[model samples]
Target: MPAFGRTMLTHWHLDPQVAYLNHGTVGATPTRVLAVQQAFRDDMERAPARFLLRELTGTFPAPWRSESRLREAARSVAGFVGARAEDLVFVTNVTTGINAVLQSSQLGSGDEMLITDLAYGAVTMAVHAVAQRTGARVRTVSIPFPPSSSGAVVSAIRDALTDRTRLAVIDHVTAMTALVLPVAEIAEVCHARGVPVLVDGAHAPGSVDLDITDLDVDWYAANLHKWALTPRSCGFLWARPDRQADLHHPVVSWGRDKGFLAEFEQHATHDPTCALSAPAAVALLREWGWPQVRDYIHNLAWEAGRRLTARWDTRLSTPEEMIGAMVTVPLPEAAGSTDADAAALRLALLEEDRVEVQLHASAGRLWVRVSAQIYNDITDIDRLANAVRQRLVVSSVESR
Candidate 1:
């Protein structure tokens, strides 16, 4: 196994001056993977027409190529997630893929789409937009923050499903709360209720051991950029064979009726280097050993949760098993509890302490979501703890 921690920062181009504990927000790509993406871009520049049309999608006959470049990259990514290449296609991000599924669905008046209160905020907006367009109702299932157990999560979703529920969207790992949900069990419950399941696995690609085939869901949308070490703006959508027929890309293009792959892969024209270079990211994962990487980060996140809660005199109500590479720790009560307060503290941490992390106000308190990566170590955690502690001391003095 390779040595992980501050030393591992050499593999990426992250600034040494700042401690970045926000990998789950927008991932940092390794220098090696960036080089690979640059090479693809260089090749495209050399022959724009041939590379984008002939090589990318194989729109024209190219004697030198047997398959399109996009398909080859898709195959590599499919293998990493334990899904067939045909079932997976790349998108700009998880939001784009989820929007495709939502737009394709045939919802109408009296229909309901089930989502949780913990779903990503942007996704919640998209669901509401669809609801407004089709006269469908959006039902939000409230899963308790800091859930007691995995069974509790499953039960919440199961109880929320009703005959009117046309589709159920679940998060494999929630964003703000940093909880790794029991998606398989939740999917099973939705299936029993005759509801199609769409999972937003934005943080699951490299954070957790993922196998799309193993989860019984109609659609799975995730980001390779966040945890998978891919370049920014790369994500994928996997659909069951039966579900593919009704799926459509969010943007209508020439590949409208060809097939699912054609619809998504040939959607207008944009930068394809990110998706084409996905294999390089997967290669790096294999080089480092996936199990070793996951173990180190997960352990780091678990320890951070324990240490921070102890320092703040708070409790980590969420079980360790529900944590992946990111853990949300409650701030000291001295820290103000409001959206504005959360933003101010987050900015203060970045500007004054040189630390970057995700923070949010939830359930009338402020919580920090710390993302543990190979480049982070205990010292980074300690830095954040001290920074917050100092703020609390200052606040106490000011109150007098």
Candidate 2:
């Protein structure tokens, strides 16, 4: 492993006083890219009418090189993730993209939507909301906390599918447990069953090598803000060319009926800078050799999990091969530790130790997830590991 040292940390505008290990929650934007975003905002502010109407609208009288900023941004992201620009559209985030897909999907009575227990909470709600309104049912697949293998994940999803299952929402990389699901295999199984697959790939964009064409999913959405060096409210939705007919934006705007791409591209009056800034973010990744950065982070995550598992004497939540840039470990159970007690422990870790991490609950158990990114190194993980171990020790003593 390479030391992604202080030089790397200087790229981001993160607080030097805190050990910021929560990149998976909402990523920290690189300062260089943030500067690019500010330029976009400044341009937008300088000529609100000209920029919005002529520039983003793609009506300015200029050469083809001066194309629409929104479209060019989409093309850059599509190229990065191995998809055609025509098939990808920018959205606020993965949650919004999932909402758009679910809202437009023709799911109704007797139809079922299959999802895993590890799905993001907001996406789970989106699935159920559409199901409830259309008299559909959501069948959740209970994947083991530390899944045996990717094959086991595929098998679980395959066994859960039924003839009534109209859609399956799978995570490329899970939110809470941080396990990378076998999305490619799961998509093949669902497609064979005549079920459309929607992948909630919130954490996959820059963390994993993505080829939407290779996955062969009907619809896939990911957040650039999470892994890519982009600011907040940035993500893209990719639909298979054949499945574009089944998709629609949540908001009906001027782009409606113009075409599928048009429908999504022209959301009324929303700032397009987040989407436009994606290329700069992608450029940063290319300049830094993202492949190397991704590998370094993955190694950091795996090592942290190993150290934490040993320190806390708790089970690892996911297997090494299935993890990318994040790992979760169950908190040691105190004699009388309740949900409230776990919440307090999380606050203490942050307020007392200045260490930020995610506390996730599933099946009535609390798990702490640690994320590794370019800005993170061994010291950050050590801080989190020490803070958690200290808290558990104190809680155990006090509980008695």
Candidate 3:
């Protein structure tokens, strides 16, 4: 581990006994950020009525909904993502935000929703439901396993579109491949064709320096819990000012008519701890130099890819330029990268080596996905590589 990595690990509460490399699946909240969430939970529990009725609403005596603190937190998060506070609304996670947009949309026969083979499964399911209900079709562009360049990506999407293409749902950073898509270019193409774009950026917020406004996408949804150091269930949905009028909450509640922010803010009776602690999460990362953290993790991911590719005699799914804080490499054919094989390998790595990582069966092959966070260093990847080598060697022997 690098000296700087050692210093960063102290701030996180990850179990040292386990070599945790699956940060992309679900992020590990820093100790300080967790403490902030705990404080909010405690306040809510202290006086449920006072906190919910008076404090949360700031009503009755003052006639104001006491969401100023949460709004401020949203403002802080907006600043981090290069969005205006009014344009962003805090949601539980990216899935919910995408669902909200899809549900509000009007799809019908011959309508098309553009997506790729690399999108997250849950989001794909949501798109499916929307399509099924309205007789719309999901137009999928099969991005190459190892994309040649961002230009190829843009061209693929542009050529795939037709007059029926109503909306394009693009992944800013694909979950399976970990390839960072050229969103700004795609958005420009979609707009020129009179098609709106919804960017599923679940893994992009903290992994990359984002400017949602600059991307010019009609809608963008991201999960802060993935890489932004926010507690579980924290995410944000942003719609361009004009697009907001077309948006609606997934679950309509008492606040339906109270404008965009209010519609999503008071969805139902739920814990606000995650949303309330959002500002602290962003602030803590900022104080630690979020940009530096992003660069460090990115470098770690790239270095891990380099080492693993060299050791396993495999190639990366995409080039280093297309990757962010996570990278995926194809496992050797003899290693068995199927659904069952990937599951077995993941379990073996955890049980035999105490190494935590992610594996997915994609493109008819098994690929190992590793994530780099501040708590991780070269040593962690080194351990992971060793475990992988041992498992593959043992598997090869048994098969022979």
List the pairs of residues colliding in candidate 1. Answer: none
List clashing residue pairs in candidate 2: none
TM-score of 2: 0.95
Measured with C-alpha atoms, the lDDT of residue 190 in candidate 3 is 89
The lDDT, on a scale of 0 to 1, for candidate 1 is: 0.94
Which segments of model 1 are wrong by more than 4 Å?
Answer: none
Regions of candidate 3 where Cα sits further than 4 Å from its true position: 1-3, 57-67
Q: Please, what are the lDDT tens digits per residue for candidate 3 over residues 320-361?
A: 779899998887777785899889989998998998999978
Q: 111, model 3: CA deviation in Å?
A: 1.2
RMSD of each: 0.8, 2.0, 2.0
Please report, as a residue range, the 10-residue window in candidate 3 with the lowest summed lDDT: 57-66
Ranking by lDDT: 1, 3, 2
Q: What C-alpha lDDT, on a 0 to 100 scale, does residue 68 get in candidate 1? A: 94
In the range 210-261, model 1's lDDT, one tens digit per residue, is 9999998999999999999999989999999999988999899988978999
Backbone clash tally (model 2) = 0
In terms of lDDT, the best-performing candidate is 1
Candidate 1, number of clashes: 0
Error of 1 at 263 (Å): 0.4
The 10-residue segment with the lowest total lDDT in model 1: 53-62
